[model samples]
Target: MTTALLLAVVVLGAALQRVSGMGFALVVGPLLVLLVGPVDGVLLVNLCGLLFSLLMLATTRGAVDWRRLALLAPSALVGIVPGALLLAAVSAPVLEIVVGVLVMAGMSAALLARHAPALDGRFAPVVAGAVSGAMSVTAGTSGPALAVYAVASRWDPRSFAATAQPYFVMVAAGSVTVKLLLTDARLPALGAWGYGGIAAGCVVGLFVGRALAGRLSPGRTRAVLVVVAFAGGLATAVRGVASL
Candidate 1:
């Protein structure tokens, strides 16, 4: 992609992430794949996602639930390696298709199970985080798993979105680390000019997204999250099919 086009997508994606709390990858991953090919694009997506969540946490520190982060983050860290290994073991296109189908199915279930029993007991968060981490590495998204947790527990949207910032920060960072260690892929250099463009885009996104976020009600936030899930699922499915 042209430098301007790349910046435009990043800015828009960063804004969506800021507004909805979990859409940077969903909004930008496919486009980046088109721009820079799949592997490099995914690396950029992971890096940009980490940046987005860092800024989010800086702005909304008080809302972070450390207790939750404690459970989710470590589990995610552990889970990423296995997820990467799983990807290595499986056929890429087939695995991606399966992952995409499962994501869509999971989203459907979450929608129906909104009124279903909330998860409890000791290992619930562990399971959620582990699954989230696995998905983050394999599919370049862990948002759907976290989204179901937020909805099933009936968390207030703002609080849920706020808490998710830290989770994304950790998961994105961890995924990048694991991808670096386990895969042959190394992140492509952006150079000084590219970095500057990214920085400017982030600055613009932060301002625009915060302004838009103020307008969302709890219901609307949930609505937006649901839309993000569908988009993520569809994108994954398309990538799978296209690869085939």
Candidate 2:
């Protein structure tokens, strides 16, 4: 039953992610934590996230902005090690609340600043990359940060998705590596089997999202993003209140 639930989360989360280029962790993390323990849930999510990102990397290869990504890669890589260390030290509840508040605030600010000047400065990518790396470790939600940076840069959807894919893949890889180094939790045999199911779901979800993307007018997409962002914030707040 637990495995089935996890699989469902993966399917639904991946569908959301395919449409938005983010939101998988936002949707999946809480439910997975409820089904499994927090630590195991995070580990499993990281593993699946890596796989999903890799798949995106392949599918969107021709569309990525190589120059922009190159500017960010160095700082992102440098930031991940320290980020991993921090994640090892922080409590999950604290991390969740912090992440939740930040996502909500960032998305709200972005929405309000729809007419604001684009962040075209050369240093923007470095700053965004560093923040993304740290957040990925601390909260398991690098999507919001990446979204902010991508939107500011004015990337078309395909370019945005492709450029953001590697960062997520790297973050997941960092999380898994750190977890393996710090803990003795054996990768369950069942988890391996579960991956197949999640992978299948992701493929189907991606196709569905791509097909639906054209039908969603810009206003509709923005509306959905607003709701998802609010939901993410609410989820985090609930966890925080429960912890308190």
Candidate 3:
């Protein structure tokens, strides 16, 4: 029953991510933590999120801005080392709460802010990459930081989604690698069924999201998705607080 529920959650979350390029963790990360315990949940979210990005990138390769990749990917990789070390020191519950709060706060701000500052300066991408990298490693979700930068840059939906695919894939890879190398931390032994479920959920969700994405208005859909993500983040934070 638990596994089935988790699969359902992943399907929904990954579907949102498919359309938005940023909602997978905000939608599913917190609940996964509650369902499987914090460490395993974060590991699961990162891996599954990575898988989703790979699948999305497969079809959207042409749309990605190659120039941005140069600035964003390396900084994110550099950020992972410190984030993993921080994860080692922090308690699971505290991390969960922090992830939840950050998700909600960032999404809310993105929605409420009518003015998006232009990313014209040379240093803008660098700062965005660093913050995104830290967030990705520590919280298993880098979308908010990327979202903020994407908004500021006035990127269209297609450009944002395509550009984000590589960013997310790299950050997740670096984060997992750091966690494995620098400390005793490891992905919980979820066995074959767990891995299978994650793969299946992401594949189905991605295809579905692709099919539906063309039908929605990007601006409106983005706002709606943020609202949903906010709700999911709230739930995760509440669970974390309740557990404490």
lDDT of each: 0.79, 0.69, 0.75
Write one digit per residue (lDDT tens) for candidate 3, span 90-183.
7655765886787677666765664756556657777778877877666677777677666656667677778889889999888777767876
Q: Per-residue lDDT for 27-107 in model 2, tens only?
A: 778875565666676676677777877876776678778888887767766766776666667766777678678767876
Total clashing residue pairs per candidate? 0, 0, 0
What digit string (tens of lDDT, one per residue) describes model 1 on residues 1-244?
5678778877888888777778888877887677677766777788888887888788877877778778888998888889889877876667667777877787787788877777655487787788889888887888877776666667676777788888988888898988888876577777886767777787788788889999988799888887887788778888888898
- Ten residues in sequence with the least summed lDDT for candidate 1: 148-157
Q: Best candidate per TM-score, number?
A: 1
Candidate 1 clash pair list = none
The residue pairs that clash in candidate 3, if any, are: none
Model 1 RMSD to the real structure? 1.6
Structural similarity to truth (TM-score) of each candidate: 0.93, 0.85, 0.86
Pairwise TM-score winner, candidates 1 and 3: 1
| Candidate 3 TM-score over all chains jointly | 0.86
